[model samples]
Target: MSAHVRTPGWFTVNVLNRAVAWTARRGISVWGSRVLAVRGRTSGQWRTTPVNVLTVDGQQYLVAPRGHVQWTRNMRAAGGGELRLGRRVEVFSATEVADDDKAPLLRAYLRRWKAEVGVFFHGVGPESSDEELRRIAPDHPVFRITVTN
Candidate 1:
């Protein structure tokens, strides 16, 4: 297990994810959920997982609440991926956000999905101080993405 990754529990992996993926597959988005599809760095085959898309000031982002997980690693290597919502697939390019710049975004993310992903943030919530957010920023890799297709 990587130091940056925090593995989710059985319930989240089996039950919650499946439910979200199921709904997103059929075109229903739950709290900005989307099935992110990117190619594996080594295998070169497409890999996917459910992710929350955060939009602030018209810009879109993907924050890895689970730390540097597989999809985040893959996204770094692939430099882009697809956001799938049922029959709608939007291809996009991704740029990793600097850790220094993550605090505000993370705060906004917490403001929106704290109930669901806050646990992964290690007690940090929307109300956390900027210093507190920055302390954990590296553990949560954030990406700024733009849809190209």
Candidate 2:
């Protein structure tokens, strides 16, 4: 059998996510919060969840700190999705970063969201070595977002 990534359970889904999604829907970004909507690979229906959209340098990214979750898989299959913050919705194409190219983005993501999702990264933090981050890159999927306008 193939290895599967761990997904969030009870409290994260029912409580934390509900609160985050509520705030994001109002355009009050709680640390770059946005609703990621992607079409399900099989169902073809839009599935949404609150996400942290990280902007590093001049580029925007979607980092899956929760590991290979459904959204990540859907994004891979769909090639694009929408990021909704209140009434503002941005349609964008996503390119999955290769494992070797993920170190910096992963580091930045941890620096910003470590308090919330650090447990999924084992013990690696923003201060961890590039080699260390590279080692765990496969577990987490990083997508580069390019606005389609």
What TM-score would each prediction reach against the true structure? 0.96, 0.96
Task: Give the Å error, residue 43, model 1.
Answer: 0.7
- Best candidate, lDDT: 1
lDDT of each: 0.93, 0.92
Pairs that collide, model 2: none
Q: Where is model 1 more than 4 Å wrong at Cα?
A: none
After the best TM-score superposition of candidate 1, give how far the Cα of residue 116 lies from its true spot, in angstroms. Answer: 0.5
Give the Cα error of residue 105 in candidate 2, in Å.
Answer: 0.5
Residue-level lDDT of model 2, residues 1-149, one tens digit each, is 11448888999999999999999899888998999999999999999999999999999999988778889989999999999999999999999989899999999999999998899898999999999998898888889999998
RMSD of each: 1.6, 1.5
Candidate 1's displacement at residue 147, Å, is: 0.3
TM-score of 1: 0.96
Q: Tell me how far the alpha carbon of residue 148 in candidate 2 is from the true structure, in angstroms, after superposition.
A: 0.9
